[model samples]
Target: MVAPLSAWPWENLGCFKYLLYGPFLAKVLYSRFHDQEASEYSWCLHILVICALRGLIHQIWSSYSNMLFLKRNFRIIEHGVDFKQIDKEWDWDNFIILQALIASMASYMFPFPANLPFWNTKGFIAVLTLHMAVSEPLYYLMHRYVLHGNSFFTHHHSLHHSSPVPQPFTAGLATFSEHLMLAVIIGIPILGASLMGYGSIITIYSYVLIFDFLRCLGHCNVEVVPYQIFKTIPFLRYLLYTPTYHSLHHTEMGTNFCLFMPLFDAIWKTLNGKSWELHKKIRSNLGKSGRVPDFVFLAHVVDVSAALHAPFVFRSFAALPFSPRFFIIPLWPLTLLALLMMWAWSKTFVYSFYKLTGRLHQTWVVPRFGFQYFLPFAREGINKHIEQAILRADKLGIKVISLAALNKNEALNGGGTLFVDKHPNLNVRVVHGNTLTAAVILNDLPKNVEEVFLTGATSKLGRAIALYLCRKRVRVLMLTLSAERFQKIQKEAPVDCQNYLVQVTKYQAAQNCKTWIVGKWITPREQSWAPPGTHFHQFVVPPIFSFRRDCTYGDLAAMRLPDDVQGLGCCEYTMARGVVHACHAGGVVHLLEGWTHHEVGAIDVDRIDLVWNAALKHGLRPVSSSC
Candidate 1:
C-alpha cells in the first residue's frame, strides 16, 4: 500500500533534490554536449558506443555487484528467495540492437541537437538544468496517469509489468506502442534542452547512456548498494532512484513513477513504504549460484523396442517359485538384466542441447536443453524429475524452463496450471511451447481446405488448435476421448463456430473431412480409418519413426525445412544449427523476439508469421504454407 505524501521520508527534500541535482548534473552533461563538434553520424556513433559502455555497467558490473550483494547479504526466507532469475530474453539478437537500430534511424531522420559552444560556459548548463528541472511533472504523469492509469495498462503498458520480477533488459518487453511512447518521454528533457541551445556531443550521449543504464539498474533485483549508502547520503533517498525503489513498482505497481528520482513519488504521495524493507528482507536470504539450463524439458521414455521384451520380466516374476530349478536359475539372469535395463532407461538427466552465444560479449546465457525428450510414460517419476530439474535451473539463475511434448502431458495434462498448482515456490516459468504450434498450423493452413479434422482434440495442443481455428471460422471435425470431453472442448470454441465445428467420438466419424491432423499419436485403427487422398499430419512426439503415405510425422519434419533448419533426430541441432521440433523452435522465436510471457498451449495468430520468418532465415522452409 502507498502512504500519504507528507508521511514520505523524503517529502521535505524535494526542494533539496531540485537545488542540488540541477547544477551538479547540468555541469557534468554540459561539456559533453556543447564542447565537441560532431557530424550527425558521429553523434549517433557516440550514442551507439556509450550504449555499449552502459550495457557493461548494467549487465556486467551491476549484475556482478548484485550477485555479490545477494551472496554476501541476501538470505532465503521460508517461502521466498532472493536473486531468483528474472525472465531475460534481451541481448543484441532479442532487444538491445533492435532498440539501438530504431533509435539510430529516428536520430538520423530527426537529428539531435548539435548546437555551438555556450555563449557563456554556464549558459548551456541552465538549459540542461532546465531539461531535468522539467522532469518532475512529466515523468510522474507518463508513468502514473498514462501507463498505470486505465486501458493503457490493459493494452500497451502492462505488458512491461507482465514479468513480476523484471531483469535489466526485460524493460524491453513492452508493446511496440509503449516503446515508442517511451522514446518520446525520454527525449522530452533533451529536446527542451536542445531548444535552449544546450545540445552538444556529450549531451545526447550522456542523457541517452545515463538514462538507459539507470532504467536498467533500477530494475536489477540485486540490491548492491548497502542501506548504509542511503544513511551516508540521506539526501540520495530523495534524489537517486534505487534498485529496490523500482523493484517495488514491479512487485506492487503504482508506487514509484519517476524514472531517475524518488522525490516525485514523495511529492505525489505515492511512495511505497515497503520498498526498502522488502529489499533488505529479500537480499538477506540470497542463495548460492550454480549452473542451470536455459530451459528444463520434462521427459520420459517408452522403449518401443523394450516393450516387446518386457513380457520376460513379468513372466519371471510370475514364475518366481521355479518349478524346474535349472530353468528358474536361467530366468533369474534375464529378470535382473530386464530390471537393470528398465532402471537405466527411466533415469532423467540433462540431455543434448545447443547454445546461442552472445554477439557482443559472446556471453553464454541461453543454452537450450533437450532434457529427456526421447522418453515417455513417467507418471510416477515425472513430477519428481521435473521438479528436480526446475530447482536445478533456478539455482543457476535460469529464469525460464519448459516441458517437452509427452512430458507436458505428464506434468499438467498439457497445461501450465498444474505446475503452478504443484510447485508454487518455483520462481521459474514452465513454458508449454504449444501456443506457437497452434499459431504455426493456423498460419500455414492450406487455403483450399474449407474443413479440417483434428483428432485427440481434448489434449492441450489439440484443444488450443481447435479454438484458434474456430475463431477464424475454419470448420473442424474434432475427435476426442469421449463425447463428454468433446463437448467440453467444443464449449470453448466461439459460439458462432457451431456451423464451422463438428465433434467426433471416433475416427470413423471424421474420415470424410479431407484434411486431417492428429495432435497425439492415434491407434492403428485410427490410421486405418484415413480415407484415400486425405492430407494428414501427425503433430505429436517420439514420432512415427517411419513415414506413412498420407501422414506427416512431427510438425517440423512435415514443414520440410531447409537443410540448415532440419533436425538431426533428437532436439539437439546439427552443428548447433536448425531447430528440433516446431514447439521448441517457437520457444526460441519468443526469446529472440523478446516476448514477455511464456508461449504455452496458446499463441497469438499475428506472431505466427514472425516466428515463421525468423525460422526461415536460419534455414527452415515455408512448406507448411503449401499443400
Candidate 2:
C-alpha cells in the first residue's frame, strides 16, 4: 500500500559522480597508452539510461502486482504491509554498470542473434554449460566457507540474510570488498572463455542477460513454474533451482547454498527439504484469488515523542521544507520549527504506528502536526495536519481513522463534516469516536449517587455528560469558565434536575461531593479540593494526564483496560500497558465490531443499551467501577 512516496529514504544520490567518472576513466586509460576499449562516456551513458529504465520497470511491475493482489483479495503481501524499504532493490543499480562493462567487451555492437548452436557462431551453449558446472561448485565453496567463515565477509553476508524475502536487486547489494570477490567469481568464466579461443562479446552478453534474469527470477515471489512439469521430469526438479530454493538460503540461511543448480546442495545435504511443500501451498493459494481483510482502523493523535524512534530521523522531516507553500506561512513554518525541536531532542518514529492482526485486519496510529506546542497556538493549522494524517492512513490502505483527543475538536463542528467536505473521495472514513466514549462512561455510572461534580462542565462532552447526569436525578456541580453560564445550562438541562445543578467558581469541601468528572487536563491539584474518599472518572485524551497531590503512578495502579480494549488513552502517562481513556476505548469498541461508518458525539440515553449490547456481542462488558 502507498504510505506516501516521501516516506521512503531511497538513496538515488551519487548518480552524477559516476556520470563524471566515466570520462575521467577514459582519459586516464588513453594517456597510459592502454589497449583499445569501448568509449567510457558512451558506456556510462548506456548504463545510466538502461538503469533508469530498469528501475522504473521494477517499481511499476512490483507495485502493480501488489495492487492487483490487494484489489482481488483480502490480505496484502508481506512487503505491502508498510511499503517495504526501497533500499534492498535500490543498491543493485550498480549492476547496470557491470552489464555495460560486459557489453563493452564485444568486438561489435549489440542486439545479437539469440539462437546460435554451441559449435557454430558464439558457442554460448557450450560456454554456458561449462560456466554453470564450474560456477556451481565455486559458489557452494564461497557461500559455505569464505563468505560465512570469515567474520569480516560474514558481516557483509549478514545483510543479505536480513530480508526473508529477497528482491530483484538483493542479489547484487553487498559491501565493496564483497563486490570485488563476486567480480572475480564472474571473471573466472570470462577469462577462461577468452583464453580457450572461443566465446565472443555475444557469448558474454547472452550469459549476462540470462544470468541476471535467472537471479531476479530466484527472488520474485511468484511461483508460476508448473508443478506437473517438475513431477513429469523428476530429474529436472532436482537439476534446476527455483525461487523457493533460493528463498530458503535467505530465511533458513544454513541451507540451500548452491545457486542455479541443486547438485551441490543435494551432495552437501543442505537443500531445504520443505521448499517443495511450501511452493505447492503458495501456488495453490495464488490460484484461489486474493485474501481480503475484515476491517481497517486508523488512530489519529498528536504525539511528538514517538517521532524520536524513527530510522533516519532527519529524513522524517523531508517533506516539512516544502509544506509551507501548500500550507499558510506561520502554520507550516511553526510545524517545521516544532519538528526541528523534537529532532534536536533526539525524537523519532513520528513516522507511523504499524500493526496487523492475526485475522488479517489492519490498524494504524497516525500523528498530527509535530507536537503539543502546535495543538493550541497553531489551532487553525492543526486541522490540516489532522487531514494529512488521515490522508496518510488513506495511503496505507486503511478505510477509517479515529480522531483522538484535540484532533476530535478539529473535525466539522466536532462531527468531521468539514473533513468529509474537503476530501469527498477519501477512502479512509473520518471518525469522531465519541459514541463509544459516551457508552463506557454511562455504563460505569455509579448507582445511589445523589451528587456529582462536572469539571469543564460546559464543554461538548462535559455538557452532554452533565445534562445526562441531571436527567438521572443526580445533583450536578458545573465547573466552567463562568459558573454564571447556568442560564445556558438551565435552558438546555432537564427541568426537574436544573435546580439540583450547582454553578461553582471553585471546588469547596463544603460541597461534600464524593464523585467528580475530571475534564481534559483537569486535576484537583489541591488535596482539600478532592476530599478523602473522592473518586473520579477521568475521560480525557489521557484520562490520567495529571494527578492530585497525593497520587502517584502507584496511586492509579489499580486501573486496567477491559478485555476488548486496545488503544489506551493513558498509555503515554503510565508504565502500565492496559490503562485506557474513555475516548480510545471507544475506537477499540468500533474495531471489535467491524463498524466502518462514523459515530460522533454522545449516544442518546435511550440507545445506550444498543452500544452496550454490541460491545457484549464482541465479548465486552463495562468494568463496573465509579473511579
Per-candidate Cα lDDT values, in order, are 0.53, 0.53
Worst 10 residues of 1 by lDDT: 359-368
lDDT of 2 by residue, 252-370 (tens): 77888876788788898888898677666555565654433323343433444333222122211221221213223434455457565643543112222222333333333333443
**Alpha-carbon RMSD, each predicted model:** 21.8, 14.4
How high is each candidate's TM-score?
0.40, 0.47
Residue 156 error, candidate 1, Å: 61
Question: What lDDT is reached at residue 242 by model 1?
Answer: 73
After superposition, the stretches of candidate 2 with alpha carbons farther than 4 Å from their true spots are: 1-306, 309-377, 388-399, 410-415, 421-428, 483-490, 509-511, 523-527, 541-582, 591-597, 601-606, 621-627
State the TM-score for model 1: 0.40
lDDT, candidate 1, at 96: 41
Residue lDDT tens for model 1, 1-627: 322221223234643523422332343466457765444235455545655675555555333432321232332211111111221232211234444545555555454533333243343475457545775567678789987878777766666776544556566566555555566666666566555655565565666667777777776555655766676888887888777778778777868887778888888898898766766555454343422335444433333222221111221111121122343455555555654564555434332332332211001111112233334553445555555665666566665665555556634343555555666676666566665566566655676667888976776667767776777778888876587877776776667875666776778886676677776676666676767666666566534433357654434332333442211222122112223345555555544555556454444444555666775555454444443
